[model samples]
Target: MPMKVRGAPQAVVAILAFAGIVVALMQTMMIPLIPQLPRLLHATPSDATWAITATLLTGAVATPVVGRLGDMYGKRRMLLIGLALLVLGSFIGALSGTLAPMVVGRSLQGLAMGVIPLGISVMRDVLPADRLGSATALMSASLGVGGALGLPAAALVAERADWHLLFWTAAGFGVLAMALVLAVVPESQVRGGGRFDVVGAAGLSAGLSCLLLAVSKGVDWGGQVTAGLLGTSAILLGLWGWWELRTGEPLVDLRTSARRQVLLTNLASAVFGFGMFAMTMVLPQLLQLPRSTGYGLGTTMLGVGLTLAPSGLVMMAMSPVSARISRARGPKVTLMAGALVVAAGYGLGVLMMSALWQLVFVSSVIGAGIGLAYGAMPALIMSAVPIGETAAANSLNTLMRAIGTSISSAVAGVILANLTNAAGLPTLDGFRLVMAIGGGASLVAIAIAAFLPAHRVPAGTLPGREPSARRAVRISARPRPAERAGLPGEDE
Candidate 1:
């Protein structure tokens, strides 16, 4: 009789994808709690806002460092460490009744964001070449999936249960993800054996912290403080670049990253991130805006969640389709196509701002485009970089996306803040302006993607299908660098 069970590759991919979704859920779960934070923590609004800032700051710092560590030691090992941080942070967030502990807890949660890239790297090392495209795409889409689905659900829980329950819930899921990783996910033996680059890591962290703090918090801190932070970031980043070029065991391989494909992909990733977030920030406000405003839909948070939830599903659903496009056309083409779709979606959003259905249409269309772009990104990065540096490259890409989102928040917030109506509320014109910007950003990303080199399918192979021969070369049903290739194990 034929075997009754799923393939080992299938199990590993499923478990890791679930882990990605859970970790992503941690990010959006806190959104509904933001408004109530000042009252809940008995602090000023500015102090309470630190909960969000702390996570953003820590995430930007941790993504690259953790990626390098994952490459040097073990991808699976670093992923576990990331999950542990999530569990610990979730519990801390649950127990905290004040701003300080809350900030600390949230920072740890930010640190856990590294797991997404690590998970993607592990997919490359462990999965058969054929499974690589689709699995990584799904894992990447989980970031959006978790965020979209998390909002309304998180809002409901915060509205009814004690808000602490949200963190408790996240902690529970983190524990489940940990257990799944131990049981199903194999440790990759593909270690980039080298000493950790302390100087590069510190320089990058300081530079990112300075820049993101200035971008994210500039509105509150005023122009001079923002200028000072920006100046400091510039100096630190320049020094960091010099040190990286000199370091024997650099934390990030600037030379490899400078290659045309990797460089352009990262640039486009940032723009795409900015475009995605512009929709995320504006749509909710449009939904919640008071009915007295001529354009407001006047919906509840739950309505917002329901409207956005379908986009997450659409993103998940589009993964295989995106993969097919990448296989048939090159991922560069896939990326450009995705960016164009996003541009089209946002352009439609600018005109169709009237009803719930129109917003749903807009979100779903944008989500589909984002899924395509994100799914193609790993393919572009992994194809360009060596097997050993997969984690680092992917992590760096993720960092770019995060930076893009931060910038989007700053820029979008500025637009909405300044373009207010007579009553001082953001007018329909303000949102349409944001939507126009989002479309323009997506179009810009498409232009960037146009610069990417074309991909040619080797002769005698079918388009849109992973080579069947490659699919058959299974690697010992374990997640290690191939013994056939004389690769060293993680313990080495």
Candidate 2:
């Protein structure tokens, strides 16, 4: 019989789940503050966007590195480091009364975004096999739940008290998360006996930063700067790819990543990320526009946050349902279904933009789709790779999603800029166009997922096998000729 571990598993789950929630909360706590930027910092709308963009850009660059490092060193160690960064960043932001300092703080907070994947990895390490499915689902839902819950609360705090208090609160949460991780999380046994790829890291970071900067600022920066930055990014990224292929120990294993299933899944993930963020980027603007525009809902920040907040609840409710569907049918099927749901939701938005409840309904539908899709992605990647490659592959998947969101933001901004209605005001038409484009991208993701092969392994297979004399005998006595030739009843 297997040796039973001590400690209440439920308590372990709660600690990790809360830690994941705190990490995700850091991502969207600034949403409510967008409107107050002009008054608080005396800055332009474009300048204020930097506060959000800075976090995104920094997170995009740091996620893959942190993920790889977590696998190499230890997930628990990295989780603690990430939480420390979150607390430090919040403290910095709390001390700030200016735009530049706040932006710096947001960048530091981005470092903590790595905690989500690290937390997920910890679940794989600690949870019993039967319990892992539900635990993983809840942990994934924490990303959406934290964002949704954080928004309304952050808005309430910002509205009633000082905006700086929001960061202070986040700092307190970060400290709590650190303590929980130290207390409950186990150290990883996995170790990478290779040097860190410094060259690849630097090259990839520079390339991605340039690409994201061009995308985020293209609306204001005009053609020349955009073209220059994009060109430089392309060249640097190409060089990085080549270097990764040649290096024995790469930051990301380009060859392994280039596998059909891995590549397509990641490509689909990018599109999914793009589509999901489009709703987030556009909804607040639509809600807050002046009533005179005839299309605006003219809602307050708190009201808008509440209205959109139910979508997170929807995601939380769907998490276990998605996991079950993936287990029963397969992850690719679940992913395709999610893409279709998202596309359908976007289609609904295009038809019913005038009604407030319609927007709420559509947002919830999209949130459900996202929850389903997000839960399936890591499972799909983990299924396809060796145990040693888990973190690197998952990190690449996360990075691809970030890249997609950056591109989507740029495209949506351009659409809104060009398609405004009369009276020099942005119209619902621009928003419609953006959603339509996002819907089309979801279709592409569905098609990609359709072609993904299904390979289901029985329990107690390769990674789960115990190191015992019976296991060795069982392995040695396996039918060799049939297995080698890929005949019927062969070992997959």
Tens digits of per-residue lDDT for model 1 on 1-492?
A: 111223398888888888888888876887777778899999999888899999899989999999999988888899999999999999999999999999989999999999999999888766766667888889888888888988889989988899999999999999999998998787777777778999999999999999999998899999999999999999999999999988777888887777777899999999989988988889999998988888999998888889899999999998888788887877888888888888999999999989999999999999999899989988788766656777999999999999998999999999999989888878888898888898899999999988877774333222222344222122222222222132211111
Cα distance off (Å), candidate 2, residue 388: 2.0
* Candidate 1 whole-model C-alpha lDDT, 0 to 1: 0.84
TM-score of 2: 0.90
lDDT of 2 by residue, 316-397 (tens): 7787776787667766777898889999999998887776898899889988888788777776765555445456677778
Can you give the TM-score per candidate against the true fold?
A: 0.92, 0.90
Model 2: lDDT of residue 29 = 86
Residue 301 deviation, candidate 1, in Å? 1.1
lDDT score, candidate 2, position 491: 20
Error of 2 at 481 (Å): 24
Model 2 residue pairs with clashes: none
* Alpha-carbon deviation at 30 in model 2, angstroms: 1.7
Task: Output the number of the TM-score-best candidate.
Answer: 1
